[model samples]
Target: MKDFLELLQRGARKRISLAELRQHYFSLYPDVQNSPDRSARLLETLRQLETIGALSLPAVGSWEKIGVPPLPQWVLLKREPKAVPRKDFGNVAWAPELGFWPELRPGQLETLLPINEFLLRRRGSLMVVPIKERSLEIYGDEKRLDGMCTGDSLFGGRLHLNTLGCFRVPQPLPYRMADAPGKPVLVVENHNSFWSFGEWNQQARCYSAIVYGSGDAFRLTGRALQQVLGQVAGSGAEYLGDLDPKGVRIPGEFNRSAEVGSPQVSPALVFYQWLLAHGVRRHRAECVSFDAASLERWLGAELAAQVAKVWQSEHWIPQESLGFEQLSAGVL
Candidate 1:
């Protein structure tokens, strides 16, 4: 999956040799799934990676056993404090911090990461191309943005590091009311749920909105949840996530480590009803599946039981499958 490859690239520091990856992934895979059936899946994933140019194959073993090319050299060397000449390194990229690489173009450079975005900003608009990666930076000088700080904007520009920046978004100021001053705050686990906060303004007025950009942000986002718990007077607050297991577990894990007296809520049935009403099929991708009823039944019977008993399970569901419309109705 794209998520898994991106995770590899991010943690491996741009590229990792093939041998290193086998050990890493093998360790993470469930022992029960380590047979030929799973190996087939692994090979399929590697082929997908090759098709996307995310993984390179150098006349060798399985495509999975290859090394990613050096991050195109220019990305590392361009970080020098001193300015360099804009010589036509012909066939070379013009990325500011990444310098020039034979394989890169102006459009592709920004997709590297936040640090690269900052570097490219310094490089000016002298024709640069990037690869097929997501970029969050506001490019070009003409279309200025508001309600955004440039320094913070650069931080937010990174697909990975934005975890920290989302934390800095405006927090609801502490308030003293006639009722219990603080109830438990709802921690939304992804950007879509966080964005949906606008539609639930009336409901949200009764609670604080804390955004954790991804399921991966559970630990970091837990800090914000802690802040709300400490500041609020009572523990009437509740947490909500998608109907899937991943959604169920994040808040459950956060509650275990961070808070007290709050309930973990799943709107699986609500989404199931909505899907039936609206006529949508569950889309399948990687670990995320849209079969709300099936997932709901599985979670209620197997996954929840496992969580309640074993305290460890890999069941995860992506909130995006329900679509924003259903999410706005609080069905995530």
Candidate 2:
């Protein structure tokens, strides 16, 4: 990382005075105050740089020195790139799953789960679910409240609906790790492997998966995942998307949005390894899993081809096709 002080100085573009230079240096290394000689040495280094013409002296007695280059390109770039905002579900309506209410909110769900928010949208009266919670408070004038909260909705287990309003609650995903009795949970994205891993729960040892319903889920589901991982701390989270380029890129964005670390696996590599062991020289993407095919179809022909090139070059997987029996036998 660039030294923060240096970066700030570059942006200001003004010569620093001697006092300012000393203050800036000491601000970053407070311990330098304890050693006068060390502090003096630092000042000497700066002076030496100026003497050698590595820095510019705008005035006879100014403390601030202009850094010389190949000036870093950072000076040319005015603003840092803005990250795309994550999808948030907050404005969705709320109501009890079965209980009756006098009035209904425009959105259907009351307590938004993290997973639900990733899939939902807000427009007019619709809203994506906010972070996972159990309850919601009824602020009168749902429309007016909507304006304050923007398009995002909140959900907690406890509903403090003091005002007369409705609430909506949807079924939550059941995430269970397959192996250790109380092992850490692992969130898997692949649908088939998600179910298969669940089925092989006893055999796999421990760790469960949360399936990605579709490409759309990657956006909002990250929060839900944080919630899930929070409940199962120490769990090893893994994303099992396709080996294609888009699949690889999505995980990177997902990690940023969730602010969590979850490494992705290459199902194609797994399949490729399996075929190599089984003496199968040739295989198609769909043979390893049709869901992989569906993903390609969804991405469209142009992007799909781009992703294929990436998988073939960087993430070729040959063992993904092997069953658990083969895996356990070390045939892979």
Candidate 3:
């Protein structure tokens, strides 16, 4: 590129026509003068010069040497030839229930052919093994399809392994068990709070379990409580969260949104009252609609009144305030 620019400066004028620029460039490299991609290759270098403020196309098919720039070492790369799209691949046949992705890039099926062929050779035999086991059998390496089954990750979401007859067990709901049947579990929102309750409850057997609510995750995973109740008949559940707008809303919203006959969720009223009394109130950068009626309806009028006053005072009591120390003290 430096040689090309220096050649133009020596033999060419301030303003050179495209033909003159090509003549100077070809004269410097006579080998590529007649190459099929000569014009494209030369244009790429010309674009580099134009980018560095050394040249400008003031008029069509004309070049203007704007200024001489201190040359930075520039590497000229030859563009790779575009791959020719395959006219077609041989007919692919998997089980009638399973098929190739609905959408294929110009030549994607050709790359994906071997996997389909392996499935076809199996004679429609479906899954008996776990997803990773099936993945190892098909691809000779496990985890090739891991985490690719969701939201366009697997072949653009055209197929899921489970839908393709490969069994993938869903992860079980995460929880800490107390093994105290027929007792209510306390589902704590924050991890520290869950740990405090989980460790204390293990010895005290105050709850059948101490479940980590995992914040918003509990809204969806609350059904796990049903699985808990199934094993511990006549058991119920209470929830403890930070004394914030979201905390107050979580239980009420979970109950309202859950399907009928879903497990009952109630506030751990005694703990919440204890939190009001002992938990330090801190100002937090939280965004929530301060709905007094919702608070009153969710917490009974008494506690709801205290929580509302806290909100009005612009402070909150996070569940973490009642840590292992407080629970271990057996004060509440």
The lDDT for every candidate, in the order shown, is 0.40, 0.40, 0.66
Prediction 3 global C-alpha lDDT? 0.66
Model 3 segments more than 4 A misplaced: 1-83, 87-90, 98-100, 106-115, 118-124, 151-157, 165-176, 202-204, 212-239, 243-278, 286-314, 324-332
**Candidate 1 local accuracy as lDDT?**
0.40
Clashes of each: 17, 56, 0
Residue 124 of model 1 has an lDDT of 44
Please give the distance, in angstroms, between residue 277's alpha carbon in candidate 1 and its true position after superposition: 7.8
Give the candidate number with the greatest TM-score.
Answer: 3
Please identify model 1 stretches exceeding 4 Å from their true place: 1-180, 202-204, 232-237, 256-281, 285-332
What shift in Å separates residue 12 of candidate 1 from its native position after superposition?
30
lDDT of 1 by residue, 38-143 (tens): 4444555566566655665444432433233211111111111222123343643334434333443322232233435455554443333221111234323211
What digit string (tens of lDDT, one per residue) describes model 3 on residues 29-128?
Answer: 5434544445655777677667665566444323333313212122232222223233444445544433554355423453355557666777557756
The alpha-carbon deviation from the true structure for residue 83 of candidate 3, after best TM-score superposition, in angstroms, is: 4.6
